[model samples]
Target: MSAIMSGAISMGILAWIWANLSAAVGVSTWAGFMGTTTYYASGERFIKGWVKGMIANMVGVLWAIICVEVSKVLHVPNIVAIMTGVISFGIVAEAKWKNLSFVPGVYIGCSTTFGMLALNGTYLSTVVALLMGSVVGLLSDAGGELLVRLTNKKETEENLVEKQG
Candidate 1:
């Protein structure tokens, strides 16, 4: 089977599992999906990509929280807007660090955090869901690779047998 087909199958299965698991845990299913998407979009190896994406996401959440707190303290009409602008700058600026270079992950995390807060979701739950989703992403990639390797091995064996016959 082609790598794309194998990956699609793996992703589909893992996404279904993540959706069910996130719902059972009372977390945001969409957040989990976002996490998985971020993992794949990261474009690094498994461990490196997962770590960088998670760190960037948590930093985004922290920035959003800081923006909220600063907005509350400033007492200005546009404090929220100002703080958002500042925090956004900080979020993108952190890409100077090699580990937090995944700017999209940071943005996704920030947006998801804001959405969760609006819906009265806890930070802990958000983190948990993201972590689980990242795990799913890792598993899905591994599973797809495994499938491809097994298929290739079988094909090679069959080809060798045919040549001998």
Candidate 2:
């Protein structure tokens, strides 16, 4: 239930921010932010999960940028992309972000990274947008949690009063 609410909130925030924030940036790059936020909202603890997810997002974004740049520079075809993927796999396999952060940074990293490539977005812009959205998502989640807890507390207090009366 909380997860659903969190996801909804994250999406809603993204939608609201899309017009002003994303327009100023690029939609493609902003989408990476949305993607990471979605993953964060759906997963575990907001702060902790977001931290890990951001780490993964950064890694992925960096890798994708490198891949795209190198691909363009060398005029290499599909092979370079494959090699990058392999390298990503090797890093994740070795580091195991899931255990360390309680979140799958590897998946987030790769998805965000590849997303940037697919959308033909700039690296710095994508990273900025992603990080911005991530911060918004985290705040939204925190705010949502606070509202729910306050509501629950009020309800509980009301129940207690009724029983006493």
Candidate 3:
């Protein structure tokens, strides 16, 4: 399906950019862009979904970075790196449980955020962003449900008319 294909394309694009683009800007921009694009395919829409998509990815990425940066500073062996990676993966899995945009953002942002977090340590900001992203996804799923109900009802009504006619 297009959803699978889009996910693939998003990953491919991320890889390519990582290889070629500047560390700070590219990661943030592409993660947000791809997250937004991929998030909508489930037919969900929130009043502020776009903002949610951006913040979720940006925050999720930063969270992953926190673990990596701390590990480097504390030099607590490679355990930090391993832990952060696992945590980031886990967060992504949680978000993806319903095919929400948060999953992609968290996955993509964490890898990028690791470096950013190393340099800046904006943990609070990242947390806030992730929360926003979660809200966006929640709204989108709710919206999708409403849309499905409306469409189905309309179809049933049309069929009833045809039958009666």
Candidate 4:
């Protein structure tokens, strides 16, 4: 199978498994999906991508929380909007750090935080779901590579047998 096909299959299988497990565990499946996507989008190796995505996501969540708190404390007109702008700037500024350079991850994390809040979900649960998703991403990637290797080996063996025949 082609690499793309292998990767897609791997991801599809893992996603299905995660969705069922997450639903049973009361975790946010959506958050986990986002985490998996973010891991792939980072385009780094498994460990590096996971670490960068998690860091960026945490920064985003922190900024989002601060934005909400500051808006509440100030109680000024359009304070939420103002705080959002500040947080947005902060999120971008965080990209200066090598470990947090995945800007999209930061944005996704911030949006996920807001989404969780809107759904009356807890941040801790969201974090857990995201972590699970990242793990799934890693597994899916490994599975895809393994599948490709196995397929290649089988093809080589068949070619050798045909030549001998």
Candidate 4 per-residue C-alpha lDDT over 40-157 given as tens digits, one digit per residue, 9 for 90 to 100? 8888857887888788778777777888778879979999889989888888887788887788998888888889888998778778877888889888988888899999899999
Among these predictions, the greatest lDDT belongs to: 4
TM-score on alpha carbons, each prediction: 0.94, 0.70, 0.41, 0.95
Q: Judged by lDDT relative to the true structure, which candidate is superior, 2 or 4?
A: 4
CA lDDT of each prediction against the hidden true structure: 0.83, 0.63, 0.52, 0.85
lDDT for 24 in candidate 2 is 66
Q: Per-residue error at 2 for model 2, in Å?
A: 6.7
Q: For candidate 3, what is the lDDT?
A: 0.52
User: Model 4: clashing residue pairs?
Assistant: none
Q: Can you tell me which runs of candidate 3 are displaced by over 4 Å?
A: 1-121
Position 57, candidate 2: lDDT: 66
Best by TM-score: 4
The lDDT ranking, best first, is 4, 1, 2, 3
lDDT of 1 at 56: 77
Q: Candidates 2 and 4: which is better by TM-score? A: 4
User: What's every prediction's RMSD, in angstroms?
Assistant: 1.2, 3.8, 9.5, 1.1
Residues 1-165, model 3: lDDT tens digits: 233454454445544554354244333433333444434532345545555455556655656766666666785567775776667666766764543346655565565454435556454544433343344344445544555666678889999999999
- Model 3 C-alpha RMSD to native: 9.5
Superposed by TM-score, candidate 1 places the C-alpha of residue 95 at a distance from the truth, in angstroms, of 1.6
Which is better, 2 or 3, measured by TM-score?
A: 2
Supply the TM-score for candidate 4: 0.95
